[model samples]
Target: MTCKEAQNLVMDYINRNLGEKKLESFLKHIRECKECYEELEIYYMIHFAIQRLDSDEHASYDIKHMLEEDLKEAEKSIRRWKIRRSYRYGMIVIAEALLCLIILTQIQGLNAGSMEETSFYRLFFQEETDR
Candidate 1:
C-alpha cells in the first residue's frame, strides 16, 4: 500500500478495526515510510494522553456539571443551526412564489394588450369595408 493509503488507515489500525490482511499491509507501509511512522507515533501519543485522562479517579462535581453544560450548549447550537436552515428554505419558497405571480401577471397584461390591439384593428377595417 502507498504511504498515503497507510496514513489514511492509521486510525483504523490503531483502533484495531482493520481486517487482518489490510492491517498487515498498513503496518508494512508504516515500517517503510518514516513520515507515516512519525505521524502514527504522534497520534498514538495523543490517544494515550486521552486514555490517561479517562483513567483518572479524581473528578470534581463541578467538572462533571461543567461538562454537562458544555454538551447542552453544543446541542443548542445545533438546534439553532437547523432552525436557521429551515427559515432560509421557507424564505426561498416564498420568494419563488412571489416571483412566479409577478411573471404571470406580466404575461396576463401582455395578452390583454394584444387582444385590445386586435379588436381595434378589426373595428377600423370594418368601417373601411362598409364605406
Candidate 2:
C-alpha cells in the first residue's frame, strides 16, 4: 500500500475497524515507510490525549461552577453582615442621642430650681438696703 493509503487507514487501524486484508496491507505500508509510521504514532498520541482531556473537561467545569456559586454565596453573606452592622451602629447613635437629650432636660430643671432660691435672696437684700 502507498503512504497515502496507509495514512487513510490509520484511524481504522487504531479503532480496529479494518478487515483482515486491509489490516495486513496497512501494517505493511507503515513498516516500509518511516514517515507514515511516525505519522501514525503522532495521530495515536493525539487521539488518546484528546480523549483523556475530554474525560476531565466535564469534571473541571463542574468544579469551576461550584466554586463560582460558593463565591457568590460568600459575597451575599458579607453583604448581610455589613447591613446588620450598619443597623446596629445606627441604633447605637439614636440611643446615645436620646440619653444626651434626657441629661440636658434634667440640667435645665436644676437651673430653674436654683433661680427660685436666688430670687428670695434678692428680695431680702433689697429690704436691708431700703433700711
Candidate 3:
C-alpha cells in the first residue's frame, strides 16, 4: 500500500473496521513504513485520549501498550480467519470430489444394466458363455 492509502485507512485501522484481507494488508504496510506507522500511532493516541476523556473511570491507561495489543490482536484475528477459510475451502473440494464419484458410480451402474440387456451372452446357457 502507498503512503497515501495507508494514511487514508488510519482511522479504519484504529476503529478495527477493516476486513481481514484489508486489515492484513494495512498491517503489513504499517509495519514496513516508518512514517505511516508513526502517523497511525499519532492517530491512535489522539483517538484513545478522546475516549479516555469521556469515560468516568480514573485508572491510568497505557496508550502505547493498548495500541500494541490492538495490532497483535488484529494479526491473530486475521490468522484465525485464514485458517477457517482454508478449512471451508478444503471441505468444499472434498464434497465436490464425493459428488463426482457418486455420479460416476451411477453412470457405471446404468451402463452395466444396458450392457447386460444387449449383450449376446444372456441368450446362451451359463456353460456356453463360459466356453
Candidate 4:
C-alpha cells in the first residue's frame, strides 16, 4: 500500500476494524515506512491519553468546569446591567411624572387667578355705570 493509503487505514488497524487483506496491506506499509510507523505511534499515544480519561467518572467535570465558570460570570454581568438599566428607567419615569405634576399645578393656579381678576373688573364696571 502507498504511504497515504496506509496512513488512512492506521486508525482502523489499531482498532482491529480492518479486513484481513486491508490489514495486511497496512502492516506491510508500516514495516517499510519509518515515518508512517512514527506517525502511528503518535496517534496511539493520543488515543491512549483519551482512553485513560474515558474511564474517569469526573471526566465531564473537568471538561465543563471552565465553561461553566465563564457562563456564570456572564450571567452575573448581564443581571447587574439589567438592574442598573431598570433603575435608570425608573428614575427617568419619576422625573417625568414630577414635571407633569408641576406643570398641571401651575396651570390650575393661573386659571384661578385670571377668574378672580375678571370678576373684580366686572364688579367695578357695573358700579361705575350705575353712578
Candidate 5:
C-alpha cells in the first residue's frame, strides 16, 4: 500500500471502522513506513484524547496506555488473520492435491481394467498361472 493510501485510512483505523483486508494493508504499510506510522499515531492520539474528554476523569488519564493496548490488539488481530489465511491456503493446496490424486487413480483404474482383458495380459499372467 502507498503512504497516501495508508494516511487516508488513519481516521477509519482510529475509529475502528476498517474492514479486515483494509486493516491488514494499513497496518503493514504503517509498519514499513515510519512517516505514515507517526501520522497515524498523531491522529490516533488526538482522536483518542477527544474521546476521553467525554468520559470519566480516571479514564482520561491513561491515554498513552490505552492507545498502546488498542494498537497491540489491532496488531494481534492481524496476526491471527494471517495465521488463519495461511492455514486455509495450505488446506486448499492439500485439497487440490487430493483431487489430482483421485483423477490419476481413476485413470489408472480404467486403464488397468482395459489392459487385463488384452492378449498381453493373457500371455504374461495366464502363463504365470500355468507355471
Candidate 6:
C-alpha cells in the first residue's frame, strides 16, 4: 500500500472498521512506512478526542443541567407574574367597591338634604294646625 492509500484508510483503520482485506493491506503499509504510521497515530488521536467530547454521559448531563435551570427560572417568572396579577385584581376590586360606596353615600345624602320643607313631618304638622 502506498502512503496516499494508507492515509486515506487511516480513519477506518483507527476505528477498526476496515474490511479484513483492507485492514491487512493498511497494516502492511504502516509497518513498512514510518511516515504512514505517524500519520495513523495523528488521525487516531484526533478521532479519540472528538469521540470523548461527544460522550453521551458528559454532554447529556451538561445539557440536562442547563435545561433544568431554565425550567426553574421560568417557574419563578410565572410565580412572580401570578402574584402581581392577584395584587392588581385585588386593588381593582377594592377601588370599584369604594367607588360604589361613595356613590351610594352621595345619593343618600342628596335625598336627606332635599326633603327639608316638603318632608312628611312638615306637611303633617301644617295640616294639623289648619284643622
Best by TM-score: 3
TM-score of decoy 6? 0.40
TM-score of each: 0.42, 0.41, 0.82, 0.41, 0.63, 0.40
- Candidate 5 on 1-131: residue-level lDDT in tens? 99999999999998899988999888888878989978987887888677667664454456556666877899899889889999999999999997986676566657777655555555667887767
TM-score of 1: 0.42
Q: Write the per-residue lDDT of candidate 3 for residues 4-117, one digit (tens) a residue.
A: 998999999888789877899999999899999899989999997888889966888788788889899998999999999999999999999979866765676577875343
Arranged by lDDT, best first: 3, 5, 2, 1, 6, 4
lDDT of 4 at 47: 65
Residue 126 error, candidate 1, Å = 99
For candidate 3, what is the total of clashing residue pairs? 0
Candidate 2 lDDT over residue span 53-108, tens digit each: 97865432343344335435544555676689899999999999979866765665
Flag regions of model 1 displaced more than 4 Å: 57-131
Q: State the RMSD for candidate 2.
A: 28.0
lDDT of 2: 0.66
Off by over 4 Å in 3: 114-131
Clash tally, candidates in order: 0, 0, 0, 0, 0, 0
Instruction: Pull out the clashing pairs in model 4.
Output: none
Residue-level lDDT tens digits of model 6 in 62-88: 433443354355445556766898999
